[model samples]
Structure formats: structure tokens, C-alpha cells
Target: MTASRPHELVEDPEYFRDVLNSMRMIADKNLRRVRFGLTGDGIAPHYEITVPDGDYMEHSVRFPINGLTHHTHHQSPEPFEVTNLTEKFSWDDVIGMLERALSRKRERK
Candidate 1:
């Protein structure tokens, strides 16, 4: 089963719409369906991005959300393996990661 989020976030219609729209905007054809949630600790925002690794193989990566809405970028890092997900961007880095995923998607197709 998928993990649940805080009640406040789940109950807010406007926030829900915004998050849905953002996820739709970032969806890539090459990757599996994108899933998002807070980290297991339930403090940091996390995204489960299933990206293609190679021929007939794919991997799900947990990427930390960093932005004005999520200010955990400068905080102490999580103890997980996120070496590939850590990159600097003027805004949220997820957009760039998704863009890369899209590019790969296009190239593969």
C-alpha cells in the first residue's frame, strides 16, 4: 500500500489541486508513474521517481524536494543514498530531473 500524508495536506482541496497539477506537468512518458510523499520520518518531502536504467530495466529513486515550499535543502542530509539526486538548481531541482527524464524518454522512443 502507498503511504499516507498528513491530514491537513490531504484535506485541502486547493493544495491537492496544485499538487496534482504540478505532478501532471512533470510527468514523463519514459518513466513509470511518479509517486510522491513525505520521507519515512514524515518531515521531508520525497518523490519516488521510476527512471529507466537500461534496456528493459528501470529503477525507482527517492529524491528530496527542495524549493520555496520545501526548505529542507540546506538542512542536514538524510542517511539514505541520494548521491545522484543531489544537484543545485535556482529553483526546485526536481524540474530539471524530470526534464532529464523527459529527454531520455524522447530519446528512447
Candidate 2:
């Protein structure tokens, strides 16, 4: 089963649409789906947000998703492991990355 978030982010009982609106906006801007961050607790995942491990690690990868798959990806210091990047653009994966990035950005702020 997928992990559950801590507190409810949208306190309003009817803010579900609003949340989706925010997510859609982020997706349009990022060229990928972006969702809210869930910081790590004893239960939350992504304790190693910067490092790739298990099903989350990938360096240079060819995405199977058409339209975006043809684009070339830039290299990074992310351990340079070869793996399929289709996960990066997946709805769930994009949201996970977005969540982790959001938490990290808040730490800097």
C-alpha cells in the first residue's frame, strides 16, 4: 500500500478542486506533474531524497513515454546509473519528485 500523509493539507472540506488546480498549474509550469511535499517522519519515505536507490535511482535514461521520450536528458551527479526514466514523467513519480523538492526548498527557506 502507498504511504499516507500526515496532517490534512487542505483544511477546507471542499478544497479538493483547489488542490488539483494548484497541482495542474505546477504541472503546466514544470512540464511535469507536481504535487505537494510530504516531509519524512518515521513513516514517510524519501529519507534519501538526493540519492537514487531501489526503484528510484536513474541517471541517463530513455523515457518510454512518447512525446517527451525523444528529448535528451542532461547528466547530473546523481551517481550516474543507467535506468529507464519513464518513471520520472509518470504521474506518480513526478508527484513524488515534486513532493520531495518542495520539502527540500522549504528547508532552504
Candidate 3:
């Protein structure tokens, strides 16, 4: 038998677009008046969403797509909550987590 090769992952822009669109649909269904966009390219793309707090101040969070699902505030390493999607996460899980994050009302001090 011939030596087996490791499976290489290819960067598919179309697939990425589809994922982005799906995320947008979820956001539209759950959240209101939020702006969504993409940040970065290739394999390290992130989903950026700007949500308005109680004071109407826009707060943006970036969610990386490569590993465990988590959202960061202003590029901080401290994520709101870490959920390992590699275990048993699904699109429903994503919607729940994202809705929680987006719906959180930030206090204005």
C-alpha cells in the first residue's frame, strides 16, 4: 500500500461567503438595527457585529471562525463566554449564544 497523505484544507471564498450570509440571517432574525461585516481574509476571517447598548452606544464584537466559538470585545482576549464547537455545537447553539451576546445591555457609568 502507498503512503497516505494528510488531508489539506483549502480556502474556499464561496463557502466563507455562505457562512457569513448565514450568520447575517441569524442576526437579522434575532437582533435589531445591527451592522455586520467581515474582517480579514483567507483562513482567518472574522464576523464583526456592532450592537447598540442601552445608552445607544455602539459596541462591536469580533467572532473568529477557526476554533472554539467565542466573541471578543474591542479585540480583547477576554471572551464573553467560550463554547467549544468542536465538541457538540450546532447552528442552533450558535444562534442562542449570539443572541445572548447581542442582547446583553451594557451599563453606562
Candidate 4:
């Protein structure tokens, strides 16, 4: 490759190693595996990724610890409601989730 690009564009192998180390630390602190993946539809434009629709825990977290409060006891936030994939379909709720997350109004129930 030519050197015309910025130095940051030339990522070193150490970048991945460092990212792995950071992820290890995060997993250790949170006690959970950090998962990341594509919603699929975004890549296919209008198309949706289908999976079984069922009830899922759809876990989330909240931070109660504060630096100023330091040693104070931490409290967990209220659990929010969500549904899981139970039956497979050609559609995905990712777009819907993205919409809701972005504060866009839902089209229908």
C-alpha cells in the first residue's frame, strides 16, 4: 500500500492485541462477555434478519457507583421490559430497536 494515507490508517497488529487486553479488563470488571455483531439488515438495506421470536431476558445494566461516593453501596437500576425471538421469520426487530433507540416514532404496534 502507498504511504499517502494517514499513519492511523496503518493499524499495527498490536492494535488488536491491545484491544484484546482492554476487552479482558472490561469482561473482568463487568463479569460478562462483551458481545458485538451486526444486526444484518443494515447491511442488506431494508431487508431484515429473522430468528425465532420468544421471550428473552434482553439484559441491560446501570451504573450506581460514583467516584465521590466511593465506598458507598451500589444499587441496581430497575429492569426494563423486552421480548425475545420465539419463532423465526424473514424480519428482524433490529430496525425497530434502532428506531426506538434513536428516538424515532414507531410506525405501528
**Predicted model with the maximum TM-score:** 1
lDDT value for model 1: 0.37
Question: What are the models' TM-scores?
Answer: 0.32, 0.23, 0.25, 0.20
When superposed on Cα atoms, how far off is each prediction in RMSD? Answer: 13.3, 13.6, 16.8, 18.3
Residues 4-109, candidate 4, lDDT per residue (tens digit)?
2121231233322222333333233333222211222222111111122233224433222111222112432321112211121111222233334334223331
User: lDDT, candidate 3, residue 95?
Assistant: 47
Q: RMSD (Cα, Å) of candidate 4?
A: 18.3
Candidate 1's TM-score: 0.32
Is 1 or 3 the stronger prediction by lDDT?
Answer: 1
lDDT tens digits by residue: candidate 3, 30-55:
44322222222223233333333444
Model 2 accuracy (lDDT, Cα): 0.29
lDDT tens readout by residue for model 1, 1-109: 2235321123223333333333443345334333445334332334333343555456433333332253233453442344333222222333444455456557766
lDDT of 4 at 76: 23
lDDT of 2 by residue, 21-90 (tens): 3334322333433222233231222111122233444542222111111111233323223221112233
lDDT, candidate 3, residue 11?
A: 36
- Give the C-alpha miss distance for residue 11 in model 3, angstroms: 6.6
Model 4 residue pairs with clashes: 52-85, 52-86, 52-87, 53-85, 53-86, 53-87, 54-84, 54-85, 54-86
